[model samples]
Target: MTGSTEASLRVEVLGSQHDRNSFECGVEPLDRYLRMQAGQDARKNIAAPFVLVMPDGAIAGYYTLSSTAVSVGEWPVETVRKLPRYPLIPATLLGRLAVDRRQQGRGYGRYLLADALLRSLRSEIAAFAVIVNAKDGNARRFYQRESFLPFPDQPMKLFRPMADIAELFR
Candidate 1:
């Protein structure tokens, strides 16, 4: 879909009104999370799940954001060198992101990820970066394409500093 067309789709907090049952991203865990645990996670203030709703009210995609912390050691050495001596750094976790299988290659994944990053950047919480734990190699590549750097020790785990992300929106 074109950027203008995608812009017309609403991105909002997941709620009872959003249909979660039919959302399938070709990933069982992702689909199951939306159908099953997303609501509970939202209610408990664990993670804030957001959904992309089509004009006809179908869910095109979803992502979750929550406060998280990472040990400084988990970062690349260059990243750690620039940080304070704090053992654990505050961050936002882009915990889960999925686009429905039908919407996969239409740029919905990038759209959802951009929305998630913007939300994280605008939050009042003191997060130094946005973190993601990619489920597989494809997922890892997806994040890397968006400039998320992989931790030296954990290739599938990645993050992009809030400052760098801010530059994109600016």
Candidate 2:
């Protein structure tokens, strides 16, 4: 994969057999959570984690996503009136995404992100958008560049509508 694309790498749903003790993404919380808590979260139906694995079975990167919602007030009044008057709008939460330090510059972050979006778009769940709670300014920028817009009053949180994502697959 050195001189080629990541076409050979595959994203696997995290499971008991996958090695989690050795995954190190250079971020304490991300690494710790993946090693110690992602499984529990998945078991509880809170969020599902996916890991990118090279053919040799090394963990390259991972991301977690779960069902969530946004308040109608999070959007502009014009948009609110057009949607259901429910207190919350359905969404998929891209909770966390991180690349192992060794795989940092190989575009695995983007790869994982594209995979997450594709999964969200393909799901039958009722989601109006895919949302992310960016950890910092840099994280926010990444999502913004990927076409996720900031909610009306939140700069650190962003979202891309499901309709927009659906258009990509067509």
Candidate 3:
């Protein structure tokens, strides 16, 4: 989609009226989870879900964020040396992110991730990083392009410090 066309997709907090039932993101687990459990997760305060709606109001994609923490032990020694000596460091989890298969290559995923990062930055909670547990190499690579770094000991667990995110947006 062209930038103008892509811009027509609007993102807002998931609501009962959004059509999530038929959304498919190619990944069965992700698509199924969003269709089946996203709302309940939101209602239970477990995570906050946001949906991307096409101009016509059809749901195109979604992502979730929640308060999370990481063990300092998961980081490189040099990285940990720069932090406080706490066992767990505050972080925000990009718990789930998906772009509908129908719209997969239209750049919706990147826009969704950028939205998630900006939302995390605006949050009142003090989070040192935005963390994402990438399910596979492709997902990890996508995040890396957005400047997220992989934990040396855990490549699939990626992070982009809030400072970096702030720089990106500014």
Q: Of the candidates shown, which would achieve the greatest TM-score relative to the real structure?
A: 1
Per-candidate RMSD, Å: 0.9, 1.6, 1.1
Best by lDDT: 1
Ranking by lDDT: 1, 3, 2
Cα lDDT tens digits, model 2, 1-170, are: 45445767989999988888878988899999999999999999999999999777888899999999788889767667778989989999999999999888878888899999999999989899899999889899999999998888888888888989999778
Better of 1 and 2 by lDDT: 1
Error of 3 at 121 (Å): 0.5
Question: Candidate 1's residue-wise lDDT over 82-168, tens digit each?
Answer: 999999999999999999998879988888999999999999999999999999999999999999999998999999999999999
TM per candidate comes to 0.97, 0.93, 0.96
In model 1, how large is the Cα lDDT of residue 116? Answer: 96
- How well is each residue in 13-72 modelled by candidate 3, as lDDT tens digits? 999999888898889999888888989999999999999999889888999999999998
Error of 2 at 120 (Å): 0.6
lDDT of each: 0.94, 0.90, 0.92
Q: In candidate 2, residue 48 scores what lDDT?
A: 98
Taking all chains together, the TM-score of candidate 2 against the true structure is 0.93
Q: Candidate 2 regions off by >4 Å?
A: 1-5
